[model samples]
Target: MMRPVQEICFFVSCGVFLLHGCGRHPLEVDISDIEETVHVERFDRELFEMKMDTADHAIGYFYERYGDFFDIFNTHIIHIGPGSGKRYPSFLSMFINDPANREVYEYTGRVFSDMEEINRCLTNGFRHYLYHYPDSTLPRVVGYVSRFNQGLFTVGHFIGVGLDQYLGSDCHYYDLMGIPRYLSKNKIPEKIPVDVLYAWATQIYPYNDSVDNLLTRIIHQGMLHHFVDAMFPQLEDSLKMGFTGEQLTWCRKNEAQMWTHLVEKKLLFSTDPLVIRKLLEDAPYTYYFTGESPGRAAVWLGRQIVREFVRRNPDLPLGVLMSRRDYQEILRESRYDP
Candidate 1:
């Protein structure tokens, strides 16, 4: 966890503070004294509210608030040109004036009219993040309209969330866009914190190993999930794993069988990208497992191994666990018989 972007993990080893309560789990710590909170800026609203009469000042203020991210939003996110271009105002006007984008923006507004619940959720999770890394700053979260381009994106210290991508699984737009039901299952308000924390966790502990084998990647996935668990101790495993309750149950009931398959098939150490994708990508179900199993079911096993590793090694700090690179050694010591 001592990487460049993770330089903020100054006290990550000291195990500073966490959110503890009466009858709280041991994984949680006391964070009542931490006065920090997360404030999410609505970039979508500001973009839509930009009127022609006062477009110049509105653009100026938006630029001030978003700065470099403005260009990122336009070029990378919305597929528009750079925000600093001379024709940027016209580009923004075109986006605002487009009837289709307008519809999406209106729908997003109706769905996310009240962000209080989400703000509070982010604050609590980030508070735990801050508690562990006292020197880190809470990421500046901004909500935007990605027109179904992406669900979320992280750059530098800013996190962007697309309101349109999360307008309920049954939203007509998703149907119109031809999104699969299994993929759309995660398009809900509740997945925001989980998604955000996972994105941040990747940044905190990016996978840089040149050896991209199945075991290496699988354990990395486990480490990321473990980090998210530490940030939100009370969160349901289904939400964290992006699995339906039934899918999670299937994973639990067949954990041993799945482990046997991986080892018996000699697929645990395969470096084939296609094999890795089959095991890890989001789909109806993991190709290697039955249809009843969840996509990335192998990752669930990875998390279990990591959980066992941490459980067996009580004195190991979270930072150390995450910083670890010897995936095979970690798996061996995990003693994860199940």
Candidate 2:
């Protein structure tokens, strides 16, 4: 939450000056000495290996190993009801027996057979997290194949990453499942850590604003992306923002024009859910902009605003940057004026 406010405000200032973030940037520091690491549990492999013959033992084993997440996955994710309910075994069996689920799980093995690289990346990312917020509890990461039901999800201190969802954009399964090109193109291994940290950032510092407006929503989204930036400093903005290389280039070239459109059209403070969705949601492009622009283009501006805010306030710790909730005050402080 605090991190995102920093992200949101980073844009307010950056957006004003043709996305030039004159403010303090999130420092890229040496984290080689940080000992923190994250290891993802292979829950997907374990779940797929469950056999009815060993039902009693396996059931107990899952309960002991995964605890609340076991029940949550059963109820909230796969939607098979509570884990301990009488019909739970039958439902789980049905899921395991499903041909489609089996196909997806098997395919996941081919793509993620070795998770060492992923573990190393996450370790480095969390090292940054520890560097910034030493008091926070690092969430346990559990890797699972959800038959494309979830890309990433969080409850309490565990983060579930759906292996099936990140099986590369060109995976035939996506075409088979009718996944849109714009969406599926981002389903690559490189995006996993960024997506994971972003999800965790949202959970730790959720959108806590009292009023819902376009500016607030855009700033919140920008802050979330900034949190990801802090965690993974080297990640490309296009990947972090889920835009194509060309799309990102377009955003930079037209930053001022986009900001002007928002101002002249008087859309910044508007709270219409439709307007929010059109600007923030995934689509081929932002309907408000030329077809050459990418979806959620406004958010790109938000990121610039926050980047500037953080840049200008170099001395402010990340926690303080994110803790700032006054979106308007952030804007005023950012001095963002496209």
Candidate 3:
């Protein structure tokens, strides 16, 4: 979940918590305590409706309801125009008038109008976070339509989700926008909590150093995946890995060959950012080894290494595992020759 820029990140995990509630009316004995469920606060819906309706207090409403977040959107999401050397009206003006963006905003609302499922997933994942790190402060979750500019981002105590980005993969607009189908397919409501929670995880368990090599970069993702697993224990691995069923099966079948290729090519320890990007960054395809190979093969390897590390150190708690920053030591200890 670590942002590629400046932001605090953290993880969701399960450990070290207990709750009990009971009552008896004999001589009087009772105890009460309730764990709160985590959920997203829907400022996006209110903001979109206000813009659409041209409400009297639209500007004031945004300023008052979202406070500094308004400034953030202006700076990051909306101030710039679609092309270089061009300009657009302020975010508010643009949102109020753009026809296509308006449709996207409405579609986003229709798709996510009922966020009970999202709330439940986040609540459960957050409980796991609370279970492991009892003292951690939960971020204030909010929803917003970002015109597909930013999917999810966090700053200070706020975690903002760009609802438009997750419209079902089959939505025709994606094709119009030239988004390849493979990448678009994962843009579903089901993946929202994982993205948000994993982003939070990066805030907590940040990669302090720059990733200069394939091993570090992929291991960074692996750690995030591992943390998400602890947080959303019931979620499928494919969802966590952002892999299709066939992609996962391919990775599994070729795990050894993949590792062998990395070693044979001397890629693991090399500090080449370009090499790292080809293996770890999202793309239509990596196109390095085989055309059929999935992109981010390094991620699969990193997950395999972390799994091996955990297997070797079975007693290490999730908290401890994340706190350790020595990737080289983790790799060495993992004995991950594969």
Candidate 4:
């Protein structure tokens, strides 16, 4: 949807932060701590390499092979530039640099791993739908990985949720779905038309049971869902309009039904930088700030939090509000410092 002018201002501030070297730091954990040996047979490696050579060919190959089982969103792909490889490392370093994030990341990783295992079991029993119908037009899996990396930056820098902290709220889902919805509603199409792009990002295949189910699963597995729900009362009124609880529930349930197939195939799990490009390109919402970076979202959210805090506690000084440690403790305690 149309972003408020304040949001634009917030975006500008985030740009300044980045320029000032205030970007999220990387985690201090050694690569060996989280790295897994990715095994691909010689034939698999050859095929994967061939697919990577041409983006169009890779998209087409995936769609031809698995289009039937999944609904491919027509999201734009971000082309990875030469220096972009450092982005993830940079993001991780932020976690390592911040004591709060380090604590949160440890907990979050364990929770995510647990959820992944459960999802693996569910997929094994039901079969992944994305594997059955891959779409050629769909963004590559690597693209998703990149988006996740950016997500880390936003969550860490703005929310200050430690790495181990489970979002434990519906906020994550609200963000995942809301950002795109806002982008689509605002008519800010990437290179592609907004409607076409929205259709792709929100498209559901036959495998997903319903949007409600999808929401339920996401909430059950991730902590962010709870956070979203907590802020819903405040944000919904401020935004002027948004989905009601019932509507969101219905949409999420239906979404789950539609995407079950894709989830089964593991198409949703990606780490490519191209995914971020596609998301921004296809976003329907515009920020007050101008830039191609995903940090804009974090800035917007940070501003919102600041505004809310000020409104609730008019007597509080701005200096205390900006204190990272104090603010983080408040967030961790689930209380507004104001």
Best by lDDT: 1
Model 1 has an lDDT value of 0.82
Error of 1 at 303 (Å): 0.9
Once fitted onto the true fold, the runs of candidate 4 whose alpha carbons sit more than 4 angstroms away are: 1-95, 116-118, 121-166, 170-245, 248-338
Can you write out model 4's per-residue Cα lDDT over 56-93, one digit (the tens) per residue?
Answer: 45545544543421111112111222222445333333
How do the residues 14-94 of candidate 3 rate in per-residue lDDT, one tens digit apiece? 211211235421111111132768788887767666643454456566657666666676568765432212243344656
lDDT of 1 at 317: 73
lDDT to native, each model: 0.82, 0.81, 0.72, 0.27
For residue 52, what is the lDDT in candidate 2?
87
The clash number for model 1 is: 2
- lDDT score of residue 331 within candidate 2: 77
Off by over 4 Å in 3: 1-34, 51-68, 80-91
Better candidate by TM-score, 3 or 4: 3
Candidate order, lDDT descending: 1, 2, 3, 4
lDDT of 2 by residue, 288-334 (tens): 99999998998898888888788788788888888878887887788
In model 4, how large is the Cα lDDT of residue 77? 16
Using all chains and alpha carbons, the TM-scores for the candidates as numbered come to: 0.91, 0.91, 0.82, 0.22
Per-residue lDDT of model 1, residues 1-338, tens digit only: 11121111111211222333568664676789999988678989888887877878887887788876676888888777876678978878888888888878877887787777777778888988887788887889889986788778888888888878877777778778898998898987777877888998898799866788998889999999999998888777877788988998898899999999999999998999999999999988999999888889989989999999999997887777889888888999999999
